[model samples]
Structures are given as C-alpha cells and as structure tokens.
Target: MKDIYLLSGFLGSGKTSLLSHLIEQLKAEGLKPAVIMNELGKLPFDSKSVDEDVPIKEMLEGCICCTGAEKMEAQLQMLLEGEEFDVLLIETTGAAHPVEAMDAVLSPYFASRLNMKGIITVADCKRWIDRDKMTPQTRMLFMEQIKHAHLIVANKVDLLSDNEIALVTLQIQGLNNHAPIIQTSNAKLPLKMITNLEATYSSQEIQQAAIGKQLSLSSRLHTFTEPVNKDEFEKWVKELPDTIYRMKGYVPLKGHKNPFLFQYAYGMVQWLPEYIKMNPQIVIIGDQVESIAIIGSAQND
Candidate 1:
C-alpha cells in the first residue's frame, strides 16, 4: 500500500516551504514523493514551487472539503494508476477543515490501497498568540486544525521573543496534549521526525470530529502587467484592512531583473528574490477579499 500524509495548516503557516524540504529529504532517502496541492485561487501558484520531476495533481478554485471533494477522488484515482511514488502528500487549502478534508481523502474505493499516515500540522507561532483578534469562526477553524494533528510543527519561532515562544507552546499544548510539538524556524525539521509519527485518530473519530460548520473564506487573483514601485506596494500593504489573512505569489518590482516571491500572513510580510522569471501575479485570500483593491493595473483572474 502507498503511504499517504496530509499537510494541514492555516493561511501563511508555511506549508509549502515545509513541503519543499520534505520532498528534498525524501528524495535523498531514495524514495519517490508525489504531491496534491489545493489552492483557493483558480491558478495553481504553489504547485509551481514543487520539483519538476515529482508527480503532482492540482485541485484549484475550491477547498477539498467542499467543492473540490469530487475532484480529489478523481485525482487520487489518477495518481494511483499513473505514479510510482512511495508516499503521497496532500496539501489542503488554508481554510479547509481537517475532518472534512480527511473524509474526502478516505474514500472507500481508494482507502485500502493507501496507508493513512498521521496529519502533520504547521502552526504559525505568531498567529496563535494573536488568534484572539480574529473572528470567532476563523479562530475556531484554526483551533480545529491543531486539535486533530498528530504532529504539530510550531513554525516561525525566529520571529517571536523568548517569552512569546514559551507562551505559544503552552497554549498549543493545552489544546492538543497528545501531539508532539516541535518548534522550528521556517518549518524546517528532520524528515524522520514526520515520517515516524503514528496515526493518532481512527476513521471513525475523524468522522465524529467533522461536525462543525464550514468556513466561508474567499480568494482573489491579480495578475500584474508590469513591475510596480516596491515602496508603493509596501505602503498599500500597510493600509490593508485586518480581514485579509494571507497573500502570496510572484510580484515584479521595478529595478529587479526577476519577480520576487512575496508572502504575507497576519500582519507580517516577507519578500525573497527569485532567480527564474515567473508570471507576475498575487493571490489574496481572506474574508470578502474580492472587494479588496490591487496596487497596479492588474485584472482579477
């Protein structure tokens, strides 16, 4: 049977970054890894970061727990037939509820062919501290993701103070004491630490926990026609309302030869230089994001 692992986390929790690391380590161990990346936007931006040689199936424009559930079963069927990978990693959208996502994956037709590994959740250390500022529904969804995780990765510890780190650790432990929490920067950790985790919940338990209402988050895709002034872009971000939770993609800036990879979560922003030229676009995910404005003459896709 093929081993299947679910990567769970909230928006901007560093799931894709961790996925890249996991793929590198798995390949070094002489094992083949495949990925199924889900995105809220119509375009599959995150899938582009995955290595070219690895088999990937993208579920776009919807969360797997709801509109994309049927597509997931079809994609899983195709992957099982066409891929020769040892492990399959399914990265759900940031707003996806863990129980519903797992239920969609545990389809009766394909369940027997896959060994269900434990869920690996990447918790944003800073987000946990400021979670009270979020809406009641959004906060509940965040807690649910952590509550069902078998192994929790407390990422972005570098941004926190010593006291903040200790407090966040204690808060997460209080929520799900059964799962082992590993604090790290940029979601970096030994591959064995994840692969060695045992399944914590049964199929029955997952069904039981999937009783809450689904979250209603939205996304907007803006394609940049030309490079914008970096300073102006930063100014716009500063003025953004608190409803916008996550923003990520390639953005072309004036004076740069290539577009820089940009990521925003909570209130923090990060920009990394990209050596290769990529399509300049950004995906904004949050509550009522369609009404949000873009800096340049970019059209929503």
Candidate 2:
C-alpha cells in the first residue's frame, strides 16, 4: 500500500510545473513515483511536461469530482498491485474539488490499502485574487478548487505585486484556516515537504459527497457521436468558439479526403496529421459541444 498525494488546483495554477519539479527532485532521493493525470479536455498537453521515464495514465474528458472519478478505485488498485510503486501522485483537472477527488480515491477498494497523504491546491495568486470577479463559464470552477485544499500553493507569484501577493495570501489563508499556505513562482516547493507533509483534505464538500455517493457518480460515461459531410464537418469545428472546453475523437470531417483529426482545450486547437504519428487522432475537449449536430448521420456502431 502506497501513500497517494492528490495534486489539485485551478487551471494554469502551476500544478504541472510543481509536479515536474517534485519528480526531478524525488529521483535524486531515490523514490519511484507514478502519476495519474485527469484531463479536462481532449488534448493531452500535460504529458509533454512530465518526465520520460515515469509511468503515466491519462483519464480523459471530464472533471474528477463528477463522473470520471468512479473509475478511480479500480484503476488505482490495478496500478498498485501491478506496478508495485512506492508513491502515487494524482494530477486532477483544474476544475476539481480536492475533497471530492479524495473521496473518490478513498472508495472501499482503495481505502483499505492506500492512505491519502495530502491535498495540494495550486492557486494562481493573481488570478484567484484578481482575475475577473465573474466566472466566464457556467461551471463554478475557480471556487471549487480554492474551497477544499489542505495545502494552498500560491503559484504564478511572479505575476503579482508584493502588495497583491500579501493580500492574496491573507485572503486564502483566512478562507482556509486549516491549510498551510506557501507562495511560489511556479508550484515550486521544497521536495521534502510534498512527500512528508501530513495533511489531508477535510471539508464539508467531501462529507456531503460521501452522503450522496450513489447520485454523485451518474455522469460516469461520456460519449460523443457525429457524422458530417466531410466538408461541413471541418466547418462545424471551425465555427465552434473557444468557450467550448474539450473536443476530440477519430471524427470524419467534411471536404477532407482522409479523416482530419483535431483536439482543443480552451481555444488551444491542435489538428493532427492524417497519418498516425506523435499521437495522431482527432480530439477536442471544450465546454459547449453539440453531439447531435456532429453525430447527425454517422453510425457509431
């Protein structure tokens, strides 16, 4: 049974950067670590930032708190018993609630074996404190990440002022009295602190989730199907605005001879080559996507 560290934070909060640093440092101390990455969108961008040697598993297209988490126990149990690693580091989606995520990991199968070491929430000190007061999307993402972490990391400190930094720290700490907050430029911290920090996510959100376990795992499976005249298919995706969160799949597009592949995360779009090389396939993950529109005549079977 290994100790699992749940690394969660808002988008661009530096969780990846911090985890990269931790991986580098841990190798020096002779610790073998594996990672479970949950992607909010279809594009697997974070994998590029990780080390080449560490084993990585990707959970695509959903928030850990909602549906994708239902698979956590089975997958983790398999990893532990199969890989026999000393440590497990979970990189949750930027929109995750630490408590909810932890609860997902602690389901009956894993609770008996693995112990949760802590919750590390990476906060964009500047964004958390000063990025537009209103949320851009319907999802209450920002608040969820901030509300339930045991360790508050003030990432992207370089973007803030000395005054802004101080105020942000005070406000976050005040909001989360139990958490030990640390300020960092890019999720940087003493490696030892991550491994040894004796903290866990304790919040009403998790308790409430536990009470509604049966209902919480409903949106577990997400599947999209669409068939467009190859030409129109291209237009459909191009017409889609950045507001959509994730979009991806081996989709047939309009006007293209071969199937054109693409994936995007928050307006960051990547169109893969028709030939399979370097993760070639079409995928895009975003907020507002119309399945019926795209899957019009395509036979999923």
Candidate 3:
C-alpha cells in the first residue's frame, strides 16, 4: 500500500512551505511523491509553489473533508491509475478538521490501496495564544485541527521567546497529550521526522470520531488579467473586510518582471517574490465576501 500523509494546520501556519520542503527531500531520496492540495476557493495558489516534476491533484472550491470529498476521491483514483508513487501528500485547507479529514481518507474506497500514515498539524506559536480572542466558530475549527494530530509542530518558533515557546508548548500538549511536539521556524524540519511517523489512530476509530461538523466559511476566487500596481494592491488586501479570514494568490506587478506570491491571514499580509510564471489570480475565504470590493476590478468566479 502507498503511504498517504496529511499536512494539516491553520492558515499561515506554514503548511505549504513545509509541504514544498518535504517534497524536495522526497525527490532527493529517489522516491516518487504526488500531492493532493485542498483550497477553500476555486483559484489554487499552493499548487504553484510545488515543483512541476511532482504530480498534483488540486481540490478547489471546498475543503476535502466536507464538500470536496467526492471530487477528491475521483482525483485520487485518477492519480492512482495514471502513475505509481511511493507516497502521497495531502495538504488540507486550514479550515479542515483533522478527524473529519481522517474519516474521509479512511473511507472504504481508498482504504485498501492507501495507508493512513499519520496527520502532522502545524501550529504557529503566536497564533496559538491568540486563539481565545477569535470568534467562536473560528476557535472551534482551530481546536479541531489540533485535537487529533499525530504530530504537533509548533512552527514559527523564532518569533517567540523561550518563555513564550514553553507556554505555547504546554498549551498544545494540554490539548494533545500523546503527540510529539517539534519546534521550528519557517516550517523547517528533518525529512526523517515525516517519513518515520507511526499511526496513532486506526481508521475505525477515526470514523467513529468524525461526527461531521462543517465550517461556516464563504470563499470566492478573484482573477485579474492585467498587472496591478503593487502598492495599491497591498493596501487593498490589507484593508479587506473584517469577515475575510484568509487570502492567497499570485500577482504580477505592473512594473515588475516576476510575479509576487501573497498570503493574507486576518489583516496581516506576507509577500514573497517568486520566479514561476503564472496568471494573476487570488482565492479568498471569509464569512460574507459578496459585498467586498477586491482590487484590480477582478472577477469573482
């Protein structure tokens, strides 16, 4: 059976960064690795970060654990039929609950061919502490992501002091006592830590655990054909409606040759200069985004 690993975490917890690093390491070891990416909106941004050599099946417009499961299964079957891979990595949306995702993966159709390796949840040290201040629904979704993890990674540790890190560790451990915790900045970790994981929960137990709760997020995909002025775009993104919790995409600046990768969680924005060529588009997730005005006169698909 092929090993299927799930990299789950909150938005801006660095799941995509960790996934990219792991994929590269897997390639170096001569292992064939395929990726199944889940995003909350139609336009996929995480897929662009991965290397072209690895095969990817992107589940967009919904989370794999809930509304997107049917499409995800079909994609997995297609990938299995098209190529042979030593392992499969599924990077779920930040909104996905680990137990619910586990239930979907452990379903009968995929159970025979795929092995439920483990769930590695990435947690941001600073963000973990701020969970209490978030909305009730957001807090529940965040808690569910950590509650059933096989491994808990307190990522972005560099931002916190030793004392802060210790407290965050205690908090995460309090919620998940069985899993081992690792500290890292930028989601950097040794490859062996991922490949050597043991399953903490069985499929039967996971199904029993998944009572089937849904996220209350509304998502939209925005596309822009023309290059935009960087400054204006940044301001627009940062000042988005309070309801928008997450936004990510590739944007081509008006005067720049290369495109910029933008990630926004809450009101904070992270920009990275990327070399890959791609169309300018963004996927945004929020509570009610139908009335929000996105920059560049973009169309929400």
RMSD of each: 17.0, 13.6, 16.4
Instruction: Using TM-score, rank the candidates from best to worst.
Output: 1, 3, 2
Top of the candidates by TM-score = 1
lDDT for 31 (candidate 2):
86
**Please, what are the lDDT tens digits per residue for candidate 1 over residues 82-152?**
88999999999999987667656755445445666767889999999899999999999999899877788
Candidate 3 segments whose C-alpha is farther than 4 A from its true place = 199-301
Higher-scoring candidate on TM-score, 1 or 2: 1
How do the residues 1-301 of candidate 2 rate in per-residue lDDT, one tens digit apiece? Answer: 5777789877777889988988888788888888888888899899788887887777888877678756675578678777756778899987676656765665433443455566788888777766567566513556556655656788888888899888888888767665677889868888766655542222321111111111111101112233346455556656766544444444444554444455444455566547532221232222222222333433321
Instruction: Return the clash pairs for model 3, or none.
Output: none
List the candidates' TM-scores in order.
0.66, 0.63, 0.66
User: In model 3, where is the ten-residue run with the lowest total lDDT?
Assistant: 205-214
lDDT (Cα atoms) of all candidates against the true structure: 0.79, 0.61, 0.74
Against the true structure, candidate 3 has what lDDT? 0.74
TM-score of 2: 0.63
